[model samples]
Target: MVTWQNIDTVMLDMDGTLLDLHFDNHFWLEHVPLRFAEKNGLTLEQAKETLMKRYRKAEGTLDWYCVDYWTEQLGLDIEMLKQEVDHLIAVFPYVVDFLDAVRSKNKRIVLVTNAHGKALKIKMDRTRLGGHFDRLICSHDLGLPKEDLSFWGELQTIEPFSKQTTLFIDDSLPVLRSAHAYGIANLLAVIKPDSKAPAKDVGEFKAIQSFRQIIPA
Candidate 1:
């Protein structure tokens, strides 16, 4: 639950918050592995096992979300691969309505994402959701991931907002926890980030299944 009247800034995550995570989930889990297997002459299972291990190593770090880093590490044209599957990128249910509702109330909507610049451009090009935001930020620009506490401070230097009056919505619990630690008063979690996956059990934080749940009447 959120008090819209008290909130002035809405920091949204792109991949899992505004956009359905199915495309990303499938891209990394299925498509990437398949291509890696083909390029490396390994079996699909072997490629998945190898890539998953590497992914875990970079978990919670900016490298995990960097297309350039992955491209060099995996010897694949990561950006090109994303374009091949750009058709799958999609906005979630009622996201536009919620954006419109926030705009109508004159709230500042900022897309604060951990997505790499290349990935962000591809998604925004397909969805055209950039026009709805007051500012668009990629963690890459700040040289820090949203999971890092320092990122919040760096973000404030450019796009200022009261920590207590801002509502940060994200699908990643770790990122939300970092924001909480940085003193962001309002936090909301996406219960179901991936349309193809099951709902997550988010403890403590208020969770929403869709943006429709928070849209003002």
Candidate 2:
């Protein structure tokens, strides 16, 4: 059983955890490339391949999230492109129930995401998630990736926290592992990417298909 003792601070991932990731997947893997290709007069496949390479090479760095990076490479106003599909930004099923339960318990919920500031803003606007979190800590603002232990160290300087008394929930294994390495006592990995997926693996930290499983009823 996962204990919630002394867990005053709760850190959560946005995409795939609190929100549906299919939208982001579609945007990056399909929509954006198609739009870019059309705008640049390039083939869709060619545009996707080129953009994918640049993004992959930028992994773990701020440039990975920079709108300017994509704008320069794809020649599209990334922000405007985001606005085109803004309707897709949506909360996952059961996310609000979970958030409500946590709030009812009076826990200090903080949104800790590796998502870029601009993207975060876009998501918050769509989902109104900012109203739920005590603090929205973006990795980009800290100039470090959440998957790095040094980022946690820097976080400590900004806001002191006890790893042993905090709970962190994320969808990515690498990010979860990083949190564990940083000594966060309680970590929950959301399995199935989408909670609706059937017959998925039991998550690493008290595997859950829905947040309602962990948040006290």
Candidate 3:
């Protein structure tokens, strides 16, 4: 549903857009809760309940995506924990072909993720997907989550692109809304972010089930 010739830059999210979200979903939902339960002397259900409440409180904030912040807050080495499950990191279907086609067409493909640097590096190292992008950015370095309007302006200061020619794809509706507000002309969402979970409801936005659907001409 995208007009390839009209798009100049292809900005993508990491966890849900370019990469399969199963790694992240399983990490937070199963792995962390299991470990937290063990450490805190609680049942898995209890740990999940407790952590979910805390996660909701931090949702959409930079702290939500901050490894250091979660490490300090949870009294856990969040980075180390992620490594224990790093083997699960994987790219989504047809992502490489999509990136190659876009690059071949000479469009600027950028990864704009909210993942902390450590988390970002771990996935990049594991998947060897770093070479596909023209630039990689973490909201932690920007000191604001993509959900914030200021993030767009701050992003432009460093990696400049015309808002009207940009195609921004993300699974997070809040972040997409912020991008829309910042005048990003083309927006798309992911139908299924977490492969193990049910598809997300992408209200009022166009979405893709696979990047294979939008490969550039």
Whichever of 2 and 3 has more lDDT, that candidate is 3
Runs of candidate 3 exceeding 4 Å displacement: none
- lDDT value for candidate 3? 0.93
| Candidate 1 positional error at 151, Å | 1.0
Task: List model 1 lDDT by residue over 76-123, tens digit each.
Answer: 999999999999999998999999999999999999999999999999
lDDT of each: 0.94, 0.80, 0.93
lDDT of 2 by residue, 111-162 (tens): 9888877889899988887998888988877888887878888888876788
**Using TM-score as the measure, which candidate wins?**
1
Give the range of the ten consecutive residues with the poorest summed lDDT in model 3: 67-76
Question: Which residue pairs does candidate 1 place in steric collision?
Answer: none
- Candidate 3 C-alpha RMSD relative to the actual structure: 0.9
Model 2 error, position 59 (Å): 2.1
